[model samples]
Structure formats: C-alpha cells, structure tokens
Target: MSAQTIKGLTYPYPEPPGKGEWIEMARGVYWLQMALPMALDHINLYAIEDDDGWWVVDTGMKWGDTQERWKLLIEGPMAGKPLKGVVCTHMHPDHIGQAGWLCREYNAALYMSFGEYFTARALTQEDHAGADWRVIEHFTSAGVPFEQVQQMGRKFRGFGAIVEPMPGSYTRLTDGDSLAIGGRQWRVITGSGHSPEHVCLYSDEDKLILSGDQIIPRITSNVSVMPQEPEGNPLKRWLESLAYFIEQTHPDTLVMPAHNTPFYGIHTRLKALIDHHRGHLAAIEDACREPKSAVELFPVLFAREIGKDQLAIALGESIAHLHYLYAEGRLERQRDEQGVLRYRSVDPDHCPYAPADLTDEDVPMEV
Candidate 1:
C-alpha cells in the first residue's frame, strides 16, 4: 500500500522529540510515546534507570521516522547514561522491532519470556522470509479458496515492514520472576492469546504495571488465529488471561498500556474487555445461523470503517471467533466445492452439532 493510504488510516508518523519533553513517571522512569500505523494508534516505551545504566521496556516500530525519534531521545534526553538492557513485552513488531538495533548499539542484553523470544525468532528467521506462501498453501489445504489465499498473500507482505530484527539471544523470563530496575522490584506476570508469552510487569512499590497490549484502556487487543499456527483459540485464552490478571493485580494499580493513556481500575477495565469479546462471540454465533465465511463476518464484527491493516486484523479475529465456536460444537463447518469452508450454527435443541462442555484442556493458549 502507498504511504499516503497508510497515513490516512491514522497511523502515527513519529517526529523527533524536542528537549526536556519526556514524561517522568517515577524515580528514573520516563515514557516516550511513538505513533503506530495500526488500529492501536500509538505505543509508549518506558525508560528505566538501572544499576548499570538504563533499560527500555519496549521499542516502537522500525519505521524511518520512528528511528529518528529514538535517535533524538538517545542523544538528547538520555545522553549521559549508556543504555543497559532491553525487555520486550511480546513478539509484536511494534514492541520488539527496535530491540535488536538497541542491543547492538548499546551492547546490552535482551530479556523476554521464553515463548515470546522463540516465537519472535521463528517469525523473523531468514528461512521464513517468504513463508507466507506456505501459510497460504496451508489454508488452501484447509479448504480456503484460491482468491482468499491470494488476499492473504497480500496481507503477509506487510508483516516484515512493521517489525525489525531481534537479538541473537535473550535471557528467558517466566512468571513470578523479579527484576530490580529504576530502584523498584518489578514482578513478571504472564498472559497469552494477545501474543504468545506476553509479559506484564508490575511494581508493588509504585502500584504501576507495564501492561503492553494485554490490558489497554481503550480498544481491545486483537486475538487472532493464523495459518502458520492453526488450532489457536486466542479468544478463550485471552479471557482466561484477563481473569487471572484481574485476580492478581490490585484494582487501584496504574496500568501503563502500550497504547492509550495510562489509567487505573484494572478490574473494571478487564470486565469491559471480557464483555466486549463475549458480545462479539454471540454476534458471530448469531450470524452463523446461516453458513458464512470469515470474510463475510468481518463487516458484521467491525461495523466501523477500517483501513486495509484494520481489515486484516478484523478478518483474522472473525476467523478466530468462528474457530472457537466451531470447536465448542456451537457451529458446524464444511468445505464447499470451491474449497472454502462455510460455517453455520447448530441448533442446540435439534442439531447434531449440539454444544458440549469444554474443559481447560479442551482449549489451549496460543498467540
């Protein structure tokens, strides 16, 4: 797509930051916000002063303009201290794209959850550069039509542009891991579905949580199922993660999400997100009373106007919800003569595809 078209979608094109403009949250902690081209709008990367030097929470996308902004921040606002380390919230391009570059420039170590690190490496591996074709073929094998497969190919080409390379190695982190940064102990909290091995950092001393995309104040995070990794019930895992997060974190904690302004009331926000997904699932199930493809369900799920990037996310989310319902036996699916899978809800009272009880093992966490 053309740059003009992409900009029209309200993607933030970052401009260099001026001097003395950084927002300091706590002792030796600051926030640098950058614009994103996706529906998420913008992302906030936190700068924390470590014992050695400095640590960054997440980096923005790998766009030229974003790189310039980072250059300004490093040379201007954070000029005195050397960057110590980097931490990625997840494998998403916007969060992890600049990690490798930062690590190389500062000679810093990168730390991420084991799952996130491996998943990011796999996606960015040289061998997988043109693997979108393989993904298209996989869906085709699953009975997706040739035309839809071509459309998917177009979507895959944009993936590399959004993400930058990752570091060669990373220190693997897990749930309950503690790290001292900015003079505070931050506990690692894990969540999935939004992205595999998504980590949220919570500091009890300051009641602040670096939520990444797990718990946004505005707009729900996209939970999708891609061909490379099918059988991913992102919606279910997302809900479970939200419940767990709410249970673990205090309601009054300040949530510094990657997108949108930092806010409080984690439990209330979690409830709203859960309700949003439940409503979408019900709407998809209702629409599936008559066989419908994921493409057809996209407009219904996202009635709001969307650009190509948003459309891609909407389609994936629709398919994800459809797959979840199908797995739940609430819907019956079959491939048509054209090799496209069609889905229709099964009547619980009379249809053979009656709903069945699902257990924790029945639904697995995926990104």
Candidate 2:
C-alpha cells in the first residue's frame, strides 16, 4: 500500500514490513505489520527490545493468520526473545485481540489505561442477543428503514469472537507515566475519542512516538457514537484531543501508528485531523438548517452516498458530529413526525468549544 503524505506530513518508511517480516525504526524499536480480514486490512505492531526480553505494543486483530504471524515473529525475527509485557493502546479488538494469548504464552504482564482495560473486560462479559428490541429501536431512531434494520439475522458477538478473554488484572498506564525499556524512556501520552484513554508513547531522546490510533499519518480514525451510548458525543472528545496531543507531542517526532506506516510531522497532522472534522461539522451544520436525521444528513457528510453496507458506521459517526454541535448549543435537536431524531442549526453561535481553523479543502468523509 502506498502512503500519502497529507497536509505536509511525510512517510519516512514508504514500504511497510510485509507479513511476519520486521524493520528496525530506531535503536531497539521494530515495526511489524499483521494482516486483518477486512477492507482496511493490516495493523502495525511494535517490539521494543529490553535487556532481558522485549515489550510488545498493540497486538494485531485475532483473525486470519494473525496468530501464526505472531508465532513466526516470535520464532523468527524476534530470535525467540521472551515478551517482557504486552501493552495495548486501547480496547479495540484489532489492538487488544491477542493480548490474553500473548500474555499467557510468555507469562508476561498486561498493561493498559483504566478505561481501556475495564471497557474491554465489560465487552467480554456483556450478554445481549436474539433480536433485542432496543438495538432495532436505536437504528430506527437514526432513520434506518425498519426493513433494512430487520435484515440483521442476529447480532454478532463481535468482541468475544475476535478478542481473547481479557486479563483480570493489569498494570494501569496513566497519561504521564514513563516506561523504561532498553535504556530508553517512553512517556505515556493518552488521548480519548478514538477509544477511551488511548495510550500513545513518546520518546524525546529517540524522536519517535507510538501514536496508536490517536494520530494515523494516513486515514483518520473513526470517532463514533455507539448504540450503547446513543447520546454520546465522541467527536467532541476527539476534537479536544488534537490540542492535547499538540501540546504533549513534539512536532519532530516520528509517529508509529497502529494502522499506517511510520511518519513525521505531528503538529500539522494533528491540526489537519482537527480541521477534517471541523469541515464535517461545518457541512452538516449548513445542511441542518433544515431538520434532518443523522442518516438523512449523509449526502452532505460523505463524499459518496452510503448504502446498507456503510449504514451502521456512517450513521454512528454522523450522529457523533451532530451531537457535538448539539451539545455545544450550536444546533438544537427534536424528533420528527416519524420519531426520528432531527437536528437544526441554531442562529449565530457563541460556543466556548472553539477548535483550530478548518481547512477549505473538502476532506473525505469516511469513518
């Protein structure tokens, strides 16, 4: 895959490490790519060399030959170094799926932020199935057709399907925590919205950061309103994270993200991500002058019209942007005659939540 240098950010490593192969990004930090069984295929994992062993960050999705690839790396590129610990950036299946198995394999400890660890544990224990009316109603409220929503034969137990059972206990990594491995200091820089308390690691001496999903050099991360939290404004939290990262991160640091290849230009990329959402907020706010449901606002929100395939994610993210404005009183919400949630922009806004200046460029609106 070719990495695009958007908004002045440059890809230092154009060719990603293929399959079980690995590339050294720094003195002891190595980059490895693993396959995923989806359109946006592939996740990047890291192995930081320690004196006695190694520390892994962001285990790949528990699908395809991901486990086999892990075995290959452990036996091959890793030279059979035992894992010192497994550090997950967040609770996402792709990032934390193999955490349990890895920890068990090496008798290593698990480390994550409080929110990520607990949320993932909760998902593994969540019990809901067989046409839960609440779920159908939630989709309907977002203006999805009853027939289309009914097409879901059964709700898939997604987390349990992909993720190994979560570890009962974990060493919590807070925002300012520092992890010392291989004589290099990596500071934990946490951000929210993509996932609660997403942990990123920054090393000023090495001039690189394990940005995770918080700062992808290529495509933007999805910040959506999940069905569980219908009124949640993750986009607000997502927008707030830009400035947080800008202040915490150095502009020269190379970003080792979970998805795309390693890249540089943190401040520009952060502002660009901020503006991308700001553009989304602006487009929908303009269209919301006429009351529209989250689903109905897709035309102005996305570069291409969404279909049933894209409905679930598109609707969730659309609602997130709307909720951000609505919560700030820039927009007001009311249900339509069909009982679908509709939003309308309020007159001249005085919101305290002022973000960075939005670019005039038309940012692609795909979650």
TM-score of 2: 0.92
TM-score versus the correct structure, for each prediction: 0.83, 0.92
Global lDDT of each candidate: 0.72, 0.80
Q: Which stretches of candidate 1 lie over 4 Å from their true place?
A: 1-20, 38-41, 126-134, 137-145, 151-154, 157-162, 305-308, 348-367
Tell me the TM-score of model 1: 0.83
Clashes found in each candidate (C-alpha, N, C closer than 3 A): 0, 0
> RMSD to native for every prediction?
7.6, 3.2
Per residue, candidate 1 scores C-alpha lDDT tens digits across 1-367 of 1112112122222242333356766677777787776534567888888766888899888864777778788888788888887889998888888888889987888999999898888776534323455567545644446676566455554345566777888998899999988689999999998888799899987888999989865456778876667667887788889999988897778777787666666787787667666666676676778888877775556645545445455555777888888888888998777666788888634433222222211111111
Cα RMSD for candidate 2?
Answer: 3.2
| Pairs of residues clashing in candidate 1 | none
Best by lDDT: 2
